[model samples]
Target: MTPLRQRMLEDMSIRNLATNTQMSYVQQVAAYAKYFRRPPQELGPEDIRTYQLYLLETRKLAPSSIGLATGALRFLYKVTLKQPWAVEEIPMPKRPFKLPVILSREEVMHFLEAVSSLKHRTLLTAIYAAGLRVSEATHLKITDIDSQRMMLRVDQGKGQKDRYVMLSPRLLDTLRLYWKAARPTLWLFPGDLPDQPITRDAVGQACQKAHRASGIAKPITPHSLRHAFATHLLEAGTNVRTIQLLLGHRSLATTSRYLKVASSTVCATTSPFDLLPKVEEPPPLTPTPPAHF
Candidate 1:
């Protein structure tokens, strides 16, 4: 690896950024450098602006992706290289606020059932059962399952914090059946290489395959199950705060977004109009005849 790359990696490591985040930042920076066929250090503010336009108009990257690339470049210049012009030069893209697509309970069941691979199905099931992020689900260890307490331990999740989520009895039974067949020693869902756990991409591919087989119209990514988990719980009248903790969201507001998508919550809510006193409708009036031209 180049010294610049090594230094940037070490900087991210020092800041305790998530592994996926670090990888993404590195890749974005590398792409930025490759675009100009020159070292990133040789580039400046104007180059960054041009490249942002290139990403938008030419590469057709989404705003969120451009924002991610911008974040990486900002970190590279501001944190790693300590460039004074970083803040003024590099601006983050504005990402639109759009609600996530959530599957209904039946849709989730159909999707999971359509997954042909036992391991993939089991993994996806556990993810939805516990409202786990794909990375958290993939990194689960055999010991993380606490059958006695009926909780699944998540270590170093999104924010490098550990938390416990509910473990369903049905999911536990499913996992046991999977264990009996696969016989994994360390990771619950081990990849082809024994030491490492399954990759997020693998889970994504499985989700896509099942989505195609199930024929559900809405897009189904691994995170869609997580969305379904939260929305389903909210619909079932689980407290938003409790769901917040279960989903490991830092803010209650993040958890509350599910309220917009929860059919039960929306339908069961009493609108202000319902509280008004009853009033009779006025009698309809006949249309006036037109005047002579």
Candidate 2:
């Protein structure tokens, strides 16, 4: 069992999975083993399928939860156990399509203004300004900001891919002020502990507090700021491919969802009724046609 755990960790490390992902997968696999009261290696495809059903039907788990468990089990069987056929019978649940919640520009400003702590405010603003995930913002280093290039280097972003995002002059100035005030030694947004980066929970709590204070009503969150960022860029006429690159999205489809959130795209053309001039019905035209006939 210990050897199996070691192999799984090594494989995850090689794939450069994020720390949070690694922990989640580890926990999922452990839970599977505990459920069966035996090592995961001893479980067959039938057992895996049964457990998934139990999660969905009896436990009333969400599709996302089932997906995560399926992924972790698949990785264990295929990657760690070197048994690709073991998970053949397990099926992935269909995830429902839902549009991401986005905040208006004014709401975003209010949310930021409601944040009382300089560190928290700056960090959330950076996430929105740079279109960064909370993890990416938390892990940012001082050297990552390139004012000359007008880009911010996001090292080891989602899927362990490093990419560059545009830097707004406004955001850069705000960051400068934040840096001077915070005087963080290493991580740009270091936590109270010297060496540790700020936890995602802390960022989330700040967002929740800000949301309550602002009373914006819309479901505002840290990620909603990111959605607002992308949507605003699309509204400003930034192309989809360019946004894909900026947001570090691997697929064009993922970035294209911003089209739904962008007001410009939806509001570009006026209704046909509004284009026509108001006039009384042309009853005279009918009588004129009969006379010509």
Candidate 3:
């Protein structure tokens, strides 16, 4: 490795950044350098601005994507090079507010029913039944399943926080069948290679095929099942804070975003019209005479 790249990676490692984050930072910085045909160390803020424009106008990257690139550049200059430029100079784009896609109980059933393979169906069922992140569900080990306590242990989730999610009886039964069939040694859902968990891509493809077969027009993904899980719970009278713990969300606000998409919450709420007291209808309202007329 080059002295510069090594130093940056060391800095990131020292901070205990996740492997995915480190790779993303390195790649973004490398892309920036490559675009200008010069090492990142040789470039100035103006060059960074130019690259940001390219990402915005020419490449048309999403705000989150652009923000990730900016984060990488910030790390390279502020942490690695110890440059004098302010971190704020590398501005992030404004994040858009988009509600997550949620499926109804019947819709979820239809979608799950479409999966041809028993293994694939069970994998997805675990995710939806437990409200698991795609990554967390994929990484689950055999030991993580506690049928006695009816809880699923999720180790090192997105923020490296380990938490326990409820394991429904129905899910447990499905998992037991899968265990009996597959006889997995390590990962609950092992990949083709020994000891490796099934790829997120495989789970995604399963959802896509199911989505098509089920004839649900709305976009469906592995994460969509998670949304359906939370929404279905809220509809069933589960508390937001309870759902927060179940979903392993760091902030209540993040969990509360589901409120926007939760049909139960919106539909259950009484309208302003309902708040008004019962009244007799006026005998035929006389047409109001306009002052000008």
Candidate number achieving the greatest TM-score relative to the actual structure: 3
Alpha-carbon deviation at 259 in model 2, angstroms: 1.2
The positional error of residue 160 in candidate 2, measured at the CA in angstroms, is 1.1
lDDT of 1 by residue, 189-225 (tens): 9998999999988998988899999999998899999
Clashing pairs in 3: none
lDDT for each residue of candidate 3 in 1-293, tens digit (9 for 90 to 100): 78998999999999989888999999998898889999987998888899999999999999899999999999999999988784867777799999987888999899999999887899889889999999998999999999889999999998888999999999999999999998999999888896789999998888888888999988999998999999889888899999999999989999998888887777878899999999998799789988883
Candidate lDDT scores, in order, read 0.95, 0.89, 0.90
Check candidate 1 and list the clashing pairs.
none
**Cα deviation in Å at residue 21, candidate 1?**
1.8
The reply for model 2, stretches above 4 Å from the true place, is 270-293
Error of 3 at 211 (Å): 1.2
Worst 10 residues of 3 by lDDT: 84-93
Model 2, 202-262: lDDT tens per residue? Answer: 9999889988999888897788988999998899888889888988998999999888767
Candidate 3 shows a clash count of 0
Show pairs that collide, candidate 2.
none
TM-score for candidate 3: 0.91
Among these predicted structures, which one has the highest lDDT?
A: 1
- How would the candidate models be sorted by lDDT, starting from the highest? 1, 3, 2
